[model samples]
Target chain A: NSKVIQTPRYLVKGQGQKAKMRCIPEKGHPVVFWYQQNKNNEFKFLINFQNQEVLQQIDMTEKRFSAECPSNSPCSLEIQSSEAGDSALYLCASSLPTGRQDTQYFGPGTRLLVL
Target chain B: AQSVTQPDARVTVSEGASLQLRCKYSYSGTPYLFWYVQYPRQGLQLLLKYYSGDPVVQGVNGFEAEFSKSNSSFHLRKASVHWSDSAVYFCALNSNAKLTFGKGTKLSVKS
Candidate 1:
């Protein structure tokens, strides 16, 4: 069983409302990644962090999504304004530093519904 | 950019029958491949991963995957599947600490 934990198994928000989710990575893991799994089962990489520093992110994340992993705090991803298209399963994964072959352990994920 | 392709979107097999899920990846250099299974309303569980050395890797729940460099494929297989094995299986590629996942294959096992 993975130790990574995510809060709010489900969330419902209307358009223009802000939606936020939190993730607590596994112990001693420094790398955290966020991914969006759509209804069609396509996964899109949103953003990732190495400890408290941003590693990489896509254009969609740069616009409406903001995420951070502060020291001694649960990492969070927040959407400034929710959209119908934003409804999906947000997954958080954590991994130890092992070059490119790091095996990321995933949380149960937060399923968001935007109406 | 590296990408993964799961040729089959859904596969149905009888309980106690053999199983194989095809996966192909496109990348320039050596590839890191992984097989993950997601139960309904749950997170992805790592079935297996292949980086180097042996081409065949064993995973939990009697699952295994073979990494083929010549064919650019990493396919998952199970000798015998149970009804509980039905779920969505995803094949992914790891590059530069990022993962590129296939759309996933929904496995339905009939009892």
Candidate 2:
């Protein structure tokens, strides 16, 4: 299994609360991607990082959702002020530089609920 | 803007039966196509991708997809599906390295 580890299997918080989801990519992978899955099982690509730099980010991600990949610390996506609309499963994936034929390894995901 | 479409929202199939999931996309240039599967309470997993090679691409767990340029479609198929194959499948496109994803199709396998 090309395992990608994510922390905090589940989280529940009130409105305006802050939440953080972490991810550890598979060994040797250099690119990381974050996605948000809503109730309809629809996935929205939030952002992705190539190495330590962010290559692309969606408008929703750039607003309220913040992500960082430090050299020493694990990659993480943090929401500053959580809302009911932010209640969704957050997923992380990592892939090689090739972007072609390189399968992305995904974490199980952290389910967040903002009540 | 780039977009993807998954026609079927949900599909139920019997075990050991053939399966097919339809996907269509709209892009300006040569788009990179991908199929991903997500089990219940799990993350999205990469099944296969097509980025300018043979129109037909094979993926893990005996899944295969054929890309049609004329139709702007990439459909996934399996010869004989197992019970464990039940999950939600998503079709995605990468245009100029930026990604656009479809809603998804939920698959249910019954014994």
Candidate 3:
């Protein structure tokens, strides 16, 4: 069983519709990361947060993608307007902030399909 | 930038046969390597990781990986393979607190 949990294992949305996914990180973990895996098996690091504060993120996240990890709440990633190109597996991972031993644990992921 | 390369995109082997998956990485600083396996429609599971310690590290399900700093390689090995072991294997490198994964290699185990 995975400690990291992502809701809505599969999602289908129309183009221009909003899509969102939620994740619950492992207990005592302060760092949360979001990655996008495309059909070609390319893993793209989207964003990461440390206790509700954004640590690192890519340029793509700044435009249409938004994410938040609030205290005592499940973290979420939202896309303002869904696009066909946005169809992919959205993975959530959590890890300790410890410098050298930051082994991340991943969730099953939410597979999104935009029509 | 740190990058991981899985030379072989696909590998085929028979059950009970010894298996090896090659991984090469490029990084200017000290390297931290990890191997993760992804079953069909499942989340990635950590097979093993390599830090600053022993060159050979043991993992779950009879999986083991050897870290070679000289060659910039971290290869995964298993003594005997099972059909259940067939899955996509990814090699990753930690760079600036984030993991950079390879294109992944698909393993096919024939009965």
Going through the candidates in the order shown, the clash numbers are: 0, 0, 0
- TM-score for candidate 3, please give it: 0.97
What does candidate 3's lDDT look like per residue over A64-111, in tens digits?
899999989999999999999999999999999986457999999999
Q: Score residue B71 of candidate 1 by CA lDDT.
A: 96
TM-score of chain B of each: 0.99, 0.97, 0.98
lDDT of 1 by residue, B16-92 (tens): 99999999999998899999999999999999999999999999999999999999999999999999999999999
Q: Fill in the DockQ of model 3.
A: 0.68
What residue pairs are clashing in model 3? none
lDDT of model 1 at position A5: 98
- Evaluated at residue A59, the lDDT of candidate 3 is 88
Per-candidate RMSD vs. true structure? Answer: 0.9, 1.9, 1.1
Clashes counted in candidate 3 amount to: 0
In model 2, the clashing pairs are none
lDDT of 1 by residue, A36-110 (tens): 999999898989999999999988734889999999999999999999999999999999987788899999999
Model 1 chain B scores worst on lDDT over the 10 consecutive residues at B94-103
| A36-76 per-residue lDDT for model 2 (tens digits) | 88887767788889878998888773388899888767899
Best by DockQ: 1
The lDDT, on a scale of 0 to 1, for candidate 3 is 0.93
lDDT ranking from best candidate downward: 1, 3, 2
Q: How many backbone clashes does candidate 2 have?
A: 0
| Residue lDDT tens for model 2, B1-111 | 888999899999999999999999998888888998988887778898997779999999999999999999999999999999999999988765555778999999999
